[model samples]
Target: MLSLRTRFTALLIISVVLVLVIAAVITAWLLRKPPEVMYDRVLAEKAEFALLLLRADPLAAQTLHITIQEKPAKDRIDQDRTDNILAEGRRQGYTADVVVLKSFNPHRWDIAIRLDDGRWAYLDFPDPAPFPYLPLAAYLALVAIGMTGIATYVSNVMMRPLRILDETIAKIRPDGIIHELPETGPMEVRTTAKTINRLATRLNAAVSSRMRMIAAAGHDMRTPMTRMRLRAEFVVDGDDRQSWLKDLDELDHIADSAIRLVREEISPAAQEQVSLDAVLRSVAEEISETDLPVEQGAIKPVLVKGAPFALKRALRNLVVNAATHGLGARVSLSRYGGEAVLTIMDSGPGIPQDLLGRVFEPFFRVDQARRQIVPGAGLGLAISQEIIESHGGTITIVNRREGGLLQTVRLPLCKPEQD
Candidate 1:
């Protein structure tokens, strides 16, 4: 199937062709009628010939042995007669008008005369003859050919800017870094390229600043957390000490999660192709050894260009999240079309429809009241989504009809040559 842009371009080309055809048709219609002056000249020439023949020898007029018949005016002349006269005229090398009159009222006889000879001679007089529809048809064909050539050239030239725009947009990274585009082409295209470059630069700077601030805050919180842990250890009551320890642990988790989010935001460029099936199988095996009730299915080696560590971390997060929230989690890996799919399904209660969209948001646990029970900062899905998107893929959640929640990760497959 063609993309929207390609279909639209094709429509444009077709429209141009249609317009050319319509214009050609209109031109042919306008040139349909023959010149009236040519007919009058033919009639005058025929009358003059009769008078000349009479003056040469009045008796010869009666001996001429030619018949003058009365008939209705035809829309077109008889092809056979026209051809014969035209041939005779050409052989005689004489330009004469052969007019076929429908009737000579009782006064004079009407006649048909053939005029000049060659292709151009047909243009001299408009009686339908020798290649009747040829001139108009030829003219239309020529116009169509010229118009098609012009339209094709113009369409190609006009599409170059759009192609450049598509390529430039494709190269933009989610990290928000902007690269300068080639400032070439029409004025409008150049202006658009410049504007996009400026916007990308601003976005890059803003995201960088945010990531730095988050990282710095996480770094700054470590000392206070350490100090709090120390003070809690000094508490006399065991329960109080345990409470303080739990609080410190929560704080540490928060700091770590924040740092991880920041690092993911500024993730380094992916360099190698990683086999996703192998990564999933490894995660499944590790979980199984721990007796987590996780099962692996139909694992196949599917390679994709990405940061291997990040991808592994993302897959691990999904598997762990499923096992933690829903018991008897099952991990499955497969390939469909040109994409690699990793699905994690759990037998636990599925998420509410309204919260499905928000599940991937950082720190947005579904059961706020039972946040502690879930044992997470609510950044697992968020991180996983980021990782998949960075690798030019998608992560989605679907509620199973039978029961439970399904986490689906789709990654574009890397070509063998690319690997």
Candidate 2:
């Protein structure tokens, strides 16, 4: 499909060309030649004048471009035209026979009249012809080129406002925040920019409100959670007490994870060059100490610009999620193109295809029954995604063909000076 600007330009050029063609047709009609009767009348008058000159003085008439000849030229004669001219001349009261001689060029013809001295008088008057092909074609081509340039310029000028709007919208950050646009340009453009700025203001307010609410809710829950923990310690039955403590622990984990997720979204961390390979090794060793099935594989030196603690936390969440849910996780770090790629592969049954998209949603569990066994609030992946994205990185999870889940995280590699 043609873009709006291209279509607009084409439409304008086509309309202009159509108008030019119609005007040209009307102009040609108005400036066209006189009818054949008028032409014949005029030719007869000129022929009679030439005959009079030839009869008066043949030598003087030849000097005046009226030649007296004993015989007509050998060029082919147009018999019909010659008869018509002779008839017209007789009708004008001239007692003379005239012949129309055809010239070698198709566009030209001459007239011959019988004079009183028995000599033929030749009058050379070429017929009017249309404009030549090459010059006309060149003129039309120049007109087309000029029209195209003018159309393109007008299209770009008209579409400038929309282009500005599109570019401003594209610059929106991953956190759903867009900066205010400069309210400048034409009236319509200024109005549009002003409206967008107001919208961005409201959007930022909404986002801030939501983050504050989450943080407040998480903080408020900790109080009740602590009271519940204190009360659960007094339960007489051992199994009942253990279950209560476990439930309370889960609630505590949920509140802490919620607070952390909000923090990751709201806070902008200072970036510094961090060795991603070293971080991966540390996270693997730490998880291994807890007896989690985390095996460190190929680790290459890759430097990325991000907060050291935040990057480590994001990586740890991913590694833990894989090892806990997918049986064992094989962690590796490598440089691919301009990015540092950290991949975690596991061996357990992969997530169902139907539920893959929902994995990134907070507190979304593939199997709710595994809540007691896995010991998570199901916000691990969500937190990891938020943190990675905040650092201008991406994290993706997919089911492996060989039976397991694969988690891949990519961050832009830092330049040499940053190292």
Best by lDDT: 2
Please give, for residues 62-100, the per-residue lDDT of candidate 1 as tens digits: 476543333324654444444444455445553554544
After superposition, the stretches of candidate 2 with alpha carbons farther than 4 Å from their true spots are: 1-3, 10-65, 73-96, 102-107, 416-419
TM-score of every candidate: 0.70, 0.84
Q: What is the lDDT of residue 37 in candidate 2?
A: 68
TM-score, candidate 1, is 0.70
Once superposed on the true structure, which residue ranges of model 1 sit more than 4 Å away at CA? 1-30, 33-135, 152-166, 269-278, 288-291, 301-308, 335-339, 412-419
Ten contiguous residues with the weakest lDDT in model 2: 128-137
Top of the candidates by TM-score: 2
* Prediction-by-prediction clash tally: 8, 0
lDDT of 1 at 33: 55
**lDDT for model 1:** 0.71
RMSD of 1: 9.2
